[model samples]
Target: MVLQFTDVRNQSHIRCGLAPMEGVTCFATRLWFSLTSQPDFAMTPFLRVTKEYPWKRVSSMYAAEIFELKNAVSYKLIPQLMGTSPDDLERIATPLLSGAPFVDVNCGCPSPKVVGSRAGSGLLEDREVFAAFLEGLQQKLGHDKFSIKMRSGFLSESEFPALLDIASSIKMAQLTLHPRTRKDRYTGRANWDLIATASRECEFSVVGSGDIVDFNTLNTLKNFAPNVNTVIIGRGALRNPWIFEEIRSGKSVCISRNALLFSLATFALLHEFQAHNPLKLLELVKQGLFFTPCLTNENLWQALYSRLTTSFYGTEQPISHLCLDKPTFAKVKMIWHALRSGLGAQFMHPQLLRSRDFCEFEREFLNIAKDYNDLIPLKYHSEFDWIYSGEKRNEKQESE
Candidate 1:
């Protein structure tokens, strides 16, 4: 489907999307964002298709909820699949295509487990293999039914041209580039220059992702890559849920504490129903929270608490009124952490993270909410130190 967002400032239109973030951008999260903000489209987290899992099982596990809520959302949601096998791709996508506008192929995930299977960004290591894989998918599921999301290259940026050439050769619906090599991971800045190049070189619609923190950054990107008409926001949206609204209005939109509390309650309740397992919910929360660890200049958690107390409801309504259990409550806290991370602030009370039960959590949360004032300006751009630890990068040497 053709999607576009109108920039009120310039009276220009461009497609803005919510980037597919594993664990974080689940169906419920997407739905929350769709209702709260305006993104032209949202991509589901990559659903890995493999022989180990039956097509029915995979569909029921991941795509089922999306199918059930397909009509409820105002924006378009494209299911993204990850697999090297054409048959697997066809099997999984066939059922989804019945409801989804189109599917997206994930070629950009840099996780070791994903790349280890010669899926995700690993496909970029071999041009012939990548070409054959795309060809097989096209032959199996028609060229128009799927799109591709990928990084610039596997190990270095130099391979981007050849990879783009191979992807553009296939007649897919659209192409989204993160512009960072697998080696770079989420560290450093995304190479917008590559996005400009892809926009100039490709026949299909090109989307630019990464480092889109706020309205200023979005404007800079549009000016830098004028031909690139589509952009995706992942981390930026987490920091400021009103980002899409801000982009459309061409101004900084401040999120109120009550709004934040309402959002947290909505997400916690939705996630609880979706996860269906407390342990699994815990794991998802940890995975989805913050991508990097750094010190900040502001007390984000206290500010949120302060804002909540002074809102229309006043102190009479506790956050625990949402009736979330300990696990779901933990998920809410992690969501706050993610919001805090992007705002360039820190969670002041580390003890909150150690709360063992719902009673303890509610008590501590209420205490924090009692003291602060109503208005705390949520800032998007702040000092962030990107740490490049954990994930093992591809060892292949870059070619000259």
Candidate 2:
């Protein structure tokens, strides 16, 4: 389905998409968000294409999840492929296109490994290859059945103009631009002006991404680039799961402590089932529930803490029981780190992070949450420093 959002002023509609995040936003995470706070569309993490495996084998891994969830959910899940060869991309994308509304080519991932292979943002480094790849894919799949997601440039902003020129000449369903160079990684603020430039220049729909952390930021982006109707949220969504709902409702939705707990529980359960590995649960906990400051309100935390330790309401086990593991404790510590950065909270709660066992971890977690209950919930702005920090320097060294 075409993603559409009503613009009350002009009686028009704009589309919304969930940004594809690597190591996060997997099937279970997407499914949970679809059920909880549905965005118009969500892009899957890039499916790496390689010659070692046949196209059919590579495509089969993602086909089941994409087909099963498309009809089951309200949002559309588009499969994104990352590779340098046009032939490899076309072969893999053929099966996915049949099940998905559209397939997206990921030309924007800044991961060192992905770029080293001359895929992802590496495509931008060579203008001819980038143009030919999109042109060839368009010829095979047709313009309306597939799309492109990309960054402005590879090493510098100077490369953006030529890259945009090449991309705009091609016909596609939509083009999502993150407006940052591969070198920038996730350090500086996203350049919205470039998005406006793209909207003005491209014939197709343009989806703006990056730094969209709240309802206000969403509004600011729209105001900045009025023609760029579609937008995507990535790290921002992790900071506040209810962001999509908040944007749709046009108000700040205060997440209740119980709601927060339930969300964590639901995400954990879904992730466990999807991955089929209990240890894999730890990854989601660290990445998924970074919105810890949501429970800072005093009264909410008090009531929530009581129910959590004593007997969680409407759950078979207490919150402590669910969290009596290294994975859960790591998640708590990650949240604390988010809180420290977002709110400038001085207390790191070192004891909580230093907890030796699950029992101590759980106890320390509760104590820390209780101690910080008096703080007010502040707007979270994710710099995404953890993923991309010092990446450019390392990449430069690697290249040398």
Q: On a 0 to 100 scale, what is the lDDT of residue 62 in model 2?
A: 49
Give the alpha carbon lDDT tens digit for every residue of 111-192 in model 1: 9999999999999999999999999988998967888899999999989989989988888888899989998888767899
Best candidate, lDDT-wise? 1
Clashes of each: 0, 0
Error (Å) of candidate 1 at residue 70 is 3.5
User: Which lDDT values do the candidates have, in the order given?
Assistant: 0.69, 0.66
Q: Which stretches of candidate 2 lie over 4 Å from their true place?
A: 1-14, 58-65, 277-315, 323-362, 371-378, 381-400
Worst 10 residues of 2 by lDDT: 288-297
Stretches > 4 Å off in candidate 1? 1-12, 57-61, 64-68, 276-318, 321-323, 342-351, 356-372, 385-400
For each candidate in turn, give its C-alpha RMSD to the true structure in angstroms.
8.0, 6.9
